[model samples]
Target: MANELDGRVAVVTGGASGIGRGIVERFAAEGAKVVIADVQDELGEALASQAGPDALFHHTDVGDQEQIGELVATAVERFGALDVMVNNAGISSPLRRGLFTEDLTEFDRVMRVNLLSVMAGTRDAGRYMAEHGGGSIINLSSIGGIQAGGGVPVYRASKAAILHFTKCAAIELAHYDIRVNCIAPGNIPTPILQSSATGEDRERLERFEARIRAQMRDDRPLKRDGTPEDVAEAALYLATERSRYVTGIVLPVEGGTIAGKVMARKAGSEIPANGAPS
Candidate 1:
């Protein structure tokens, strides 16, 4: 897909790591001049440097609307136009015992980082795309948002909000020829997971994560873990003209985890009269 995004300009938030980094690299490879927006100066700069002249690193805290505005303007000033906007910066809420023990201390921070940033990115990017002949906006969501589960309730709510917002924005932006969509990634191991933990919690998290991964391997139909590149590929599809007709959709790059759990069966097993495997 070399040069697939020729002459295009893309801005990806949280481009310093994980899925966001993957998208930045992919976009640069496809011939798009990309702006890497993130709070991690060192990592972002290194990634931009590695991407060569087509990429630029910009320090941005998407939680601030003014900074987001600046990021959009920076892309236009440097690259001439903003053709794609990726609202990929997100943080996971800390895992707690249960709803009873939850104090919701990080509620505001999580919403600001995960939900408000996406809204601001879409609105700001849409304003530009609306007048400049339209463009694509890809928002990152998670499988946790799609399915109701325990643990990080706040994060789930924020991602669920993103899913709905993307659809609503798509409908409203359609008149302006701007496209809005979402990519919900599942079971992709990234550093973001570790960032949510501390000393004791970190140890517990590791064990919990291991158990979850083991279960996911059995539950997910594909029997394999997902990668940041998997989500990036989905973003690329939404970013380019290939999906011109597609909008207001939640694309799950979850290895069929949302489809249903894989049914276990023995090799050459036969069903008995009671419908049990023999």
Candidate 2:
């Protein structure tokens, strides 16, 4: 897969860390000129430097539609073309005791960052791709959006919105050759969870996160935690021509977490009658 994306240009929002950083690194390794857009200037710049001349960092706040427009334009100006746009910047809502206790404090911020940013990115990038030949746009959603959960309702809602919106955009932009898709990642440890908690709440969040991770491992069919690199691999597929016929699809990179609970059975267990293990 090396150099699969050679001569392409990509803009990855939230390109400094986590899955987004992994995407940037992978894209650059494949010979794409990438613009690393993120508010984390230091980390983004460091990453761009590490990626060599094929990558550049741009300080961007995806929450602002104006900034998103600028990001697209800057990518075009710097790279002379835009072939892929990855709207990966997002924020998680605070974990309240329950939905009832949620004061809806972070609703607007979460919506703007998680949902609105994707919309703006798609619109901005779609416009350019429409006039130009065409391109791929990848949005980052979450398994939380696919399955109903109690905590982080706002975050879930935002991501669900992205899923639907991606489909709509794909239909509309297909005529122009611009492809739109989403990647729903799950059970990947990143700083986003901790960023949503505060002092005492942070400790509670850590405990809650530990319990959830344990449950996820038990429930996951693969029984292994996903890594940023896993999601990055998905992004690479959507970015390159290998997926030329794919669009408006929601790809789940969750190690089969959303499929269903993994049937528990002993190492040498025998199948019982009625096809139910006992």
Candidate 3:
């Protein structure tokens, strides 16, 4: 049997590290010609090198429309066609220890990097993919989009917008055979989360961890932290012909996070708080 993505071409934004990097590697391993698009030149180039000849690195800041256009142009130039575009470029503001106000500038930056960047990449790459041939476009959303995020309001809002954008675009591009989808990831143990904590704030970070586990306890039916490969597997499904019938859907790569919510409520009822409840 042939590999799922054999001979296909894939473009992943922010492919230098974390979830995007994992997706790029998986796509490459499946035999897709991958493009690593990120602002981190050294790491991106290194990653591309390790991905083999089929992978190319382009220094891209998705917040810049011109750069995104160039990124698409580079992919087509190198690989001759674009088959899958994963808009995974994003960043979070510095995490707050507790309920703290965010800077107005940070809010703007979050919106630009998380939301508008996806819009730009999707618009350009979707058109390119449609024109070349029908392809898959995967937008990286977050579990926060569907739930409340107290620490990162802007990040939450931006991800929420991306989910809607994925839906709206899926409808518009269906005519062209370009399937658009979004993946909402659960609490994955990525550097993105670790970077938010400070060495001096160990207790604060521990509290944050407890809260995350609590949230996820009810949030996911599966009691565990997600991995980057988990999300990549979902991307593979969306990118390949395996899911040819699926389009414009938001797949929660959340390991029962979405599925286990109701069951968790029942579980909570059965195991009531020892000191406070009946």
Please identify model 2 stretches exceeding 4 Å from their true place: 201-205, 266-278
Of candidates 3 and 2, the better by lDDT:
2
- Candidate 3: residue 213 Cα off by (Å): 4.8
Summarize candidate 1's per-residue lDDT along 1-278 as a digit string, tens digits: 56889999999999999999999999988999999999999999999999999899999999999999999999999989999999999998887788997788999999999999999999999999999999999999999899888988999999999999999999999999999999999889887666555344667878877887887788888977899998988898999999999999999998899998788777878887999777
Better of 2 and 3 by TM-score: 2
TM-score of structure candidate 1? 0.94
Residue pairs in steric clash, candidate 1? none
Tell me the number of clashing residue pairs for each predicted model.
0, 0, 2
Q: What ordering of candidates by lDDT runs from best to worst?
A: 2, 1, 3
Tell me the spans in candidate 1 whose CA falls farther than 4 Å from its real position: 198-204, 270-278
Which lDDT value does model 1 have at 47?
98
Per-residue lDDT value at 149 in model 3: 57
Q: Where is model 3 more than 4 Å wrong at Cα? A: 97-100, 195-219, 260-278
193-230 in candidate 2: lDDT tens per residue?
77766454666878967987898889889877899999
